[model samples]
Target chain A: MNVLYFAWVRERIGVPSESVETQAATVNDLVEELRAREDRYAAAFADTSALRVAVDQELTDFDAPLAGVKEVAFFPPMTGG
Target chain B: MRIIVQEAPFDFGQQAQAFASGRQNMGAIVTFTGVVRDDASGALTAMEIEHYPGMTEAALTAIANDACARWSLGDVLILHRYGRLTPGEMIMMVATAARHRRDAFEAAEFLMDYLKSRAPFWKREVTAEGASWVAAKDEDEAALDRW
Candidate 1:
């Protein structure tokens, strides 16, 4: 799956997107895998409450199933108008 | 319905005129433009807007379609700009056309409300001190509950 980040999350993670090989079944499980990878990932995922998730470009919760998902994006709450 | 997500500046007046013209059945047209506001400190330099390339258009289209489904709208136009924008520049605009003013006005408002929180765009305000991401306001989220 391809994992993406935006805004401050991207800044903290030091990359916009990455291809990840994971056995996670849900968004939360994927976050855990990434968070355990490095300190930067841990710092970015340190406080999930300040973050939002989208699976396959659709807004969804962290607990959303990642079955057959191709992309996952994490970012701050949108501030557009 | 038209949805445009671009990095270049758009001519609001031209777009507004074009959207309102040649519409005999639509009696009313309401357009709203959002500007990049400078901070009170006056040290702000630019507003950098970041958005997901594929999801931005999809999200805006879905929101506009929802407005059309809920209201008696003739047409809907949404234009949002990304990249570095200086203060006083236009950030985005939404125009709604309907047979009645009520529908046009309400639908335009609905588009604005949803575009604010639901869209995938994020804004970072650049100032002399530093650049920081704009935090989403609680009121913006609460505003959606009224609809």
Candidate 2:
């Protein structure tokens, strides 16, 4: 699956986008998997309280299922005027 | 109800005039423009906006539709420009028309909030130091919660 980052989220993660092979079943599970990888992922996922997720272009919660999801985007809320 | 996503510049006066001309009973017109900032507090210098082709359009269309459904809006126009944009460049514009000022103002504000938090565009900025991606802000998402 492809995971994308935006704004400061990309900076914290060290990459704008990445394709990872995972065995996660839900968005929260994926976050946990990434958190296990290293410090960068841990920092990015450190405060899931401040982050928002979208799966396959639809806004969803972290606990949402990602069984067949192709893309997952995580970012701070949004600040567009 | 027109939605445009392009990299070109637009004329707000012309757009507002056209919208007003078409509506005989509209009493208010509200518009909002988002400009590209010269700096993103060191995160970005020059910025490029990337979006999911079909998904971007669909998401924006749905936002505009949602605005129309919630308000007594007469017409709505949303234009977001992508690609590489310089500082002070216009990033997007949203205009709304309604029979009353309150409805027009609230709808316009609501539409902008929704687009900011829900749109699929990703922005990467370049500076003299290096290039980095911009992250969404918590405040931006919180703004929509009021509506």
Candidate 3:
């Protein structure tokens, strides 16, 4: 699966996108897996409440299933207009 | 319906003239434009807009489609720019057309409300003091409840 970040989340993670092979069943589970990978991931994923997630380009909750999901995006709340 | 997401600036007057023209059955057309606002201290340099490449277009299209479904709209146009923009520069615009003034006005407002929170774009205010993300507002979220 491909994982992406935007805005401050991208800045904190130091990368925009990456390919990750994971056995996680949900987005939060993926976050845990990323947190365990390194301290930067740990600090970035430390606060889940401040972040929003999208599964396969659709806005979804952290508990959303990752089955057959091709891409996952994490970012701060959108301030679009 | 037309959705345009680009980095270049757009001509609002020309676009509005073109959109409002050539309408036969549609009696009303409404347009809204968002401009980059400066900070209170006036130290702001620019506003940086960041958006998900593929998802931003899709999200705006979906929102416009929803508005079309709910209203008796003749057409809809949404244009959003991403990149660094100076204060007083136009950031985005939304135009809606319908048979009546109420429908045209309501659809434009609905588009604005959804785009404010639902679109996959984040804004950062750059100033001499530093830069910071424009936090999503509770009131903006609450504004959606009225629809």
Provide the clashing-pair count of each candidate structure: 0, 7, 0
Instruction: Give i-RMS (Å) per prediction.
Output: 0.4, 3.0, 0.5
In terms of lDDT, the poorest run of 10 residues in model 2 chain A is: A72-81
Weakest ten-residue segment in model 2 chain B by summed lDDT: B38-47
lDDT of 2 by residue, A1-81 (tens): 999886677878999789989889999999999999999999889989888788997778999998888989887765444
True contacts kept of each: 0.88, 0.39, 0.90
Candidates in order: C-alpha RMSD to true structure: 0.7, 3.8, 0.9
lDDT tens digits, residue span B1-147, model 2: 998888778787787677678677998989888888874564455668776555678888899999999999999998888888877778888899999999999999898888876887777777888776677776886887898
Q: For this target, which candidate reaches the highest lDDT against the unseen true structure?
A: 1
Q: TM-score winner among the candidates?
A: 1
Candidate 2 regions off by >4 Å?
A: A11-19, A38-40, B37-54, B121-142
Whole-model lDDT, candidate 1?
Answer: 0.96
Alpha-carbon local distance difference test for all models: 0.96, 0.82, 0.95
Query: What is the Cα-based TM-score of model 1?
Result: 0.99
Which residue pairs collide, candidate 2?
A6-B134, A7-B133, A7-B134, A7-B135, A8-B134, A8-B135, B46-B126
Model 1's CAPRI class is high
- Candidate 3 residue-wise lDDT, B1-147, digit = tens: 999999999999999999999889999999999999875757889999999999999999999999999999999999999999998999999999999999999999999999999999999999888999999999999999999
Error of 1 at A2 (Å): 0.6
Clashing pairs in 3: none
lDDT of 3 at A35: 95
